[model samples]
Target: MKKLIWLVFACMLALPGYSQESATRGTANNVRQPNVIVVPYAKEGQDVRQLIENNPLVSRAVSKVKEEFGNRGFTTKDFVTLLKASKRNDIISATTGAKSDPVKDVVLESKADISVEVKIFVNKHANGSSEVSLELQAAEAISGESFANASYTSDKFITQDSLKLAERALGKVNDDFFTQLQNGFNEMMEKGRNLNVRIELGPNSGIDPYTEMKTGNDLETELQDWLSNNSYGGNYDINSSDMVIDISMKVPIYDQVSGKPYNVTKVRGPLISFLKGLLTSEEHEPKTKASSGQQIWIVIQ
Candidate 1:
């Protein structure tokens, strides 16, 4: 009887451990891993394409970081391929009289969830030894909010192979750096991604805050209702005046219907459609301006 009781007690103890292990596996499977892109850092007045093309060290460091991300099961995008495609689009936009922002265009086109900028520096000592330092900065692609950074300097070595030196420096902080980045992305997924929107009344616009819409609500109330319905979990902050409405809202990281990552373009279309419904005359229309990072601007005229 004592042996039987001991066996039952042992079974009870093992149950909790098994349950915990199952729960951990479930969480790991549920977490969505963000796609990442690594690019060489460019200073003011310096082009990123030029930097990557002319500097072998920068190119090598970028490749190393991208490979590390891939090894960790994260999907990585190629910056050079995206940059080349963006340049082709820029020429078409230039002829059409459309404005171009290269950095924003590349990031938006790539559709990478995170953009990492890499910078490398090397110093030579009189004793013929050289030390290499690498810096990595990561940000949410659409929001431009920085989430992770790492800076490491390698021990002095007689070999001048910058790639080897960079690998040594990166190896020291790889675990911690990736941990921070994944944590940041997980938090963003839970809380929803952020977007900033501004609505302005252009000159001669036929509507005002107090105007009654076809839905029997005032213009301001209609706009508020639209935002409340569209934002994720109805979460948003708004600042409004007679002529302008500025909103900072949280939207789902992925579209519920499509199960695909959301971008500014997806959000812009629906908003323009809603604004168009408020227009009572052909003379006034909803005009959408270009998006700047995470911010979108619309003028009703």
Candidate 2:
């Protein structure tokens, strides 16, 4: 039996044009128009503003990448437009800085499916040849998990136009990113998407997260159980304090109760209902926001 199993596995691996992966939930036939957001920076540790404002090369690089994504059928967002539209400066700061909090806030609000951060360095040698070095990383907006990374350098300087150079360099990296993106999306669908949950008690609410529940379990334990059971693989994180419970975890793409995949519009109702019953509080209101991808705020009174 062991030998037969091994033989089967080998044959499976050898099968031509066959794959074990499946499309992400809610995406049919591996065709989904994911919202793609592209942000360009000058280099590692440099603020994106430096590129967005000071460098023409960076602008060209960003535009090229955006165009490439558009050509590939992705619904792309204008990052510059987003920054300008956001009243919250923190989101803008986080986009250009190393701080992730603001980024998460923006992602949550925008609900983008894929976020791409690109860093470019363009050098013109004395021989009149230009070298464009690119470091590109693509992450799932919901989970903040990196799905693709590419570092490529343009060796042949076919054009003196920095814009053209930037475009060509990004093309190389984009190819690699798209190649890995499909598989990564499939894996994320299988594992589920991450959600950031914050639970708080109203000013007069008697609920205490650290207190014991009627089921012989503490509030934290009970909450954990509920979150885990609702999740795809019983996976979750809980940061419980005296007054608050913060949870970050993966929830199933499909809700067992509805037998349908979850999305921005459909997710909140089930979550709010489940949470209200679980807490058994007198008055509860849940707010679902798309930050980092999707965040839920539950307040009990």
Candidate 3:
């Protein structure tokens, strides 16, 4: 009888263990991976598109790095394709005398969560041997905050193939390189994304920071409260005065209402609704002056 009881107790304990492991596996499988874009690093006054097109070494390095990320199951964006589209847009805009920043346009249009810039260096010796090194820097796309950086150099080889050289250099640091990026990205996923907000009073609004709204709270206080309540985990910083209010906050990756990926446009709706309650007059209605990426600008007139 004692043996039977022992067996049942052991089975009960093992069942919970198996169930917990299954739940963990299910959660991990459901976790979404971030989209990444790889681009060649360019110095000031140097065009990245031109560099990648003209320099074989740079082109191969970019391709190899992107391949590594894609092989690891990351959704990778093709920088060359994006560059072509950006260049076409620039050509179109030139007729109207409009200037566009190509790098900024590509980065924003790609809608990538992270941007990785790659730099490659090569040295050739008189003995027909070559040495290659690469640097990888990853940053958050929306906020431009750098999170991971790694540098690796390969041993001298007789081959002149830049792709092979880059592959060797990357392979040396592959484990550590991805570990850093994964940790940084995981932290970002937990903490939410960065967003910047600017609020201003229009010239003829007849309102100031101290103006009381229907809620019986001053304009600044009301806006502050709204931001605090809306921001992820109530995380935000504010700089306020009579002229303007600047707020930096963290927003969730997914919209609470739609459960879809969130962006500046999605955040603008709730903010406009809140502002409408404060500025009832049509003339004093809130208008969004800018809504792009992680930035939102509103003016109450």
lDDT of each: 0.78, 0.66, 0.77
Best by TM-score: 3
Model 3 bad stretches (over 4 Å): 1-30, 43-45, 85-87, 91-100, 121-133, 154-168, 256-260
Clashes counted in candidate 3 amount to: 1
lDDT of 3 at 282: 75
Give, for candidate 3, the lowest lDDT window spanning 10 residues: 22-31
* Candidate 1 deviant stretches above 4 angstroms: 1-29, 84-101, 122-131, 155-165, 206-218, 263-266, 276-282, 291-293
- Put down candidate 3 lDDT per residue, 16-41, tens digits, no spaces: 33455434323222246778999887
**So what's the TM-score on candidate 1?**
0.74
- In TM-score terms, candidate 2 sits at 0.61
lDDT (Cα, tens digit) per residue for candidate 2, span 1-301: 9999999988886664234432223332233446788876433344444447778877777777888888888788888776667887555554445555654555556657777777888787888788889877888876668887878787768467777777777668555577687667667756777877777766666777866555767778777777666665677888977677888878654443453445543445666665565554445444443332367776665
TM-score of each: 0.74, 0.61, 0.76
Which of the predicted structures, 1 or 2, would earn the higher TM-score when compared with the native?
A: 1
Sort by lDDT, top down from the best: 1, 3, 2
Worst 10 residues of 1 by lDDT: 21-30
